[model samples]
Target chain A: MDLTVKIRNKTLPNPVGVASGTFGYGEEYAQLTDLSALGALYTKALTVEPRPGNALPRLVETPAGMINSIGLANVGVERFLTEKIPYLETLTCPVILNVAGSTEEEYASVISRVDSQNAIWAYEVNISCPNVKHGGMAFGTDPVQVERLTKTLRKLTDKAIIMKLTPNVTDIALIAQAAEAGGADAISCINTVMGMVVDINSRKPAIPAISGGLSGPAIRPVGVAAVWRVSRVVTIPVIGLGGILTWEDAVQYLLAGADAIQIGTGNFVTPDASVKVLNGIISYMKEAGFQKIEDFHGHF
Target chain B: MKNFGSSILNQKEIAIGYREMTISWPQSLEAPLPGQFLTVKVTENPAPLLRRPFALSGFDREKNTASLIYQLRGPATRLMATLEINSSIEVLSPLGNNFTLPEKDETPLLVAGGIGLGPVLYLARELDKNGFSPRLVVGGRTESFLPDLSNLKNGSIHYCSDDGSAGFRGTAVDYLKSLDWKELPSARLYSCGPQGMLNACHNLALEKNIPSEVSMEQMMACGVGACMGCAIEVIGPEQYARVCKEGPVFDSRRIKWT
Candidate 1:
């Protein structure tokens, strides 16, 4: 089994990547985990401008999941390039910049800027942002839009472009196909699924934002299923996500045909979750008659 | 995530049957400030996908222990109240930002309600250790529901109960009317607790022109800033900031509390 994978022509030491949003810029939780151990790091979604985010009670616990609508509050692009990007350059793994935009112009602006700088390993295009009332059901929902965005980036820069898809879409396979046709080098399936949690007593929403994206273990099955379904449809590799907590869980995605796995909600509960998951994968491989982590990718 | 299986540290009942647990983890306790919090993995089996967020009441750097206070509110926190000491817990900590304390020689005033006293106590001690003594004003619904956090520090403690069960009856707010506002003419106010209490403190601080900072408690996913899970509106100015990131602590005036 070979756990190593090459995406956008870049070689990853392993098949595990820390899911975006869970590990905020990675700089916030450095003391809690070994940042270098993970195969790669995905930053929090960076919008074209600085945002203050939504209002209070942004989180609500469901029976087996969590709902959030962070409204993509970020330090904007300029601040990220100067302050965050420089710090990101020091990390051992390549940093995948998760870019969100309301318009193609904004997206193009972010790409050209980040592309100009050589710090980032690749660009992770976010099409699943639910909090914003955007240009349509978001750029990723419509397959044509996804293809156009991918093709646009394909023309803009030589860096590997990974289109992040929202699970709420009607057909993830169609979306993935469109991305591939548009020249996307890879696809990371299942950005947060849209969700809402209301306070029964107050008859109001829990989050300051009326609604938010759902993440954590409850969404794992949904995410993995999408990855499996889409991986079967697209020739390009898939970076699986949604509720990945341990190494054993990550291996399931590999067996389901994911070239890589992103640990999202786990980072919130345990910062070193990526390290633990990676180690667990290595140990499981040795015990399960597998030689490498990559060998398990798509065996199912 | 290091789950110790069953080594629960300290559990004590406060306010009805609600109990608070202080768990031990090997992780460093560096980032958390006075008002910041942590997300503790609840349940021997996690029924909830997210860990419950708790205020970092205090921590022992020498022992690598993080203390959390909570009432037995639901199925999850109820599970947390049932842990035994020495049980190893899987946790992520030093999680959020802390409250800002007054400089040395300044007398601080801390206002708290129910379990809200947790973070304020840590702030009080941080101030005390640095040679500034803060006056403690605590409140609760009834004497029985009040917590017995008697060991926090040697600061002058004032108590108020809604049902007249203890101290100056009729709410912590009522006692405020009788205090010598001039004696502490130049004081920085620190507060935590229920929203009504916080609002009252905010109003009073503004009326008195006293500088104030507050700890905002909200249900959160990722006690860090990423999930956008714990943002509170800084009311008057109309901006939303994460209770976990921009703060578990905000200058009282900055909070857009309606």
Candidate 2:
């Protein structure tokens, strides 16, 4: 009946977390739903400097998904420590600071600046964002660069480090192994899949950037498969995410070997999506006679 | 803002392509003001994955009800059209900033086009109830494209059609230009419509030195402003502001019209 998930020295209260960038610094959704119900609250991506992000028409709807090119719009690390931390400190759930940058030095500097805050529970290294022109998918696609960045950031903080991986690679397991080799505590797999939608009359891309990261129920299979592949290659816990809209979708990831699951695009669909997911998972475990989160893994 | 479920009290088609849906509003929640919006989870189906946002067209404080006027366009709205009365739906409401009231000395000139008539009508009605003589000019492709306005009273309502089949023979901006500025020297503009009409209104306001505000539309996700998906370019250091957060309503001067 226990739902606690442990990653290295840290312990997540449950297995359900709202994905980074989906939950904005814990302040936006505070009025809508209960925050303490989450096992972890992953903040929006924090970079070395504030980003204005992409231009207008940043989002467009597809059949069962939406494409976005937000380009890591954030208030930067200094604002994260000063403006965001005061509110994050009031939350009961573990706050995983999602860090992203264009270079290794920028990533290291961000971690060094905010690493001292006790309110931050862990660091979710974002190396797989597809919307950016630099650093994001570039560092993620190459295993050598992934290993180097992970190792460098590992030395900066004693907190748990979760390497987020992109699905737009030839062999995702290889990248997971590189992260494990570089001393990552855990790995969150399958960032948004690269996708595009075109306007037939205008003969132009629906979004201004021409291409964006596709998320929602459409990318669920890709994420589950990525979790299955990456979980087999790396010994560390695999936190699965992508198009988890319901609790049943989360169970699919747990059965596929994801130690924990994150609700990303589903948050926009239902504000209390994570809470529903967590409650559903608990009911499922009880009905299946499973005691802990690991019991839902490897049963397939 | 709060996320709660409400039963559909009524749903009826008021025009060829548009329908007005009235739902029971919770008395505990603050009453929605003009230009403020709500996002509706259209269906449990995954095809329309995200909630669709709509502005509050009308609110009956005595009855504890709020209504939205939506066009029967796209898969989400098309699905919404099929919803029967008494059907339960999830709603996240009173989101974004509301339209600010004009100064007592200023005349409110409200303009609407196409499906944008909802908030403008709401604003005009609220202004009228508050003892201001608001002038509402509605424009569409033809008379059929506009919603039925027989229920809206206490305000001066003008209708314009492209083919001159309704009231005036031009766009809403054309009607605005046709007004004698010297008569209503303190006229302030508030508009919601197509980009072309909004831009034209912005230009007219600039030319006449009239203060103006506009309701902007963009494809949105997480209407609570978490996703930063509904971005509108503006003249500022930040460059972009979320249409769902900073506005669905903003001063006309703030927008960087192309």
The TM-score leader among the candidates is 2
Question: Every model's DockQ, to 2 decimals?
Answer: 0.55, 0.86
Task: Give the poorly placed runs of model 1, Cα more than 4 Å off.
Answer: A135-137, A208-210, A292-294, B1-7, B20-36, B58-66, B103-106, B124-133, B149-154, B235-238
In the range B37-80, model 1's lDDT, one tens digit per residue, is: 66677753547567777777766667766677787777877777
- Which run of 10 residues does model 2 chain A get worst, by summed lDDT? A76-85
Off by over 4 Å in 2: B151-153
TM-score for all predictions? 0.91, 0.99
Model 2 lDDT per residue over A116-189, tens place: 88899999999999998884799999999999999999999999999999999999999999999999999998
Native contacts recovered by candidate 1, as a share? Answer: 0.72
Per-model TM-score (chain A alone)? 0.95, 0.99
| Candidate models: Cα lDDT each | 0.77, 0.92
Candidate 2 chain B minimal-lDDT segment of 10 residues: B146-155
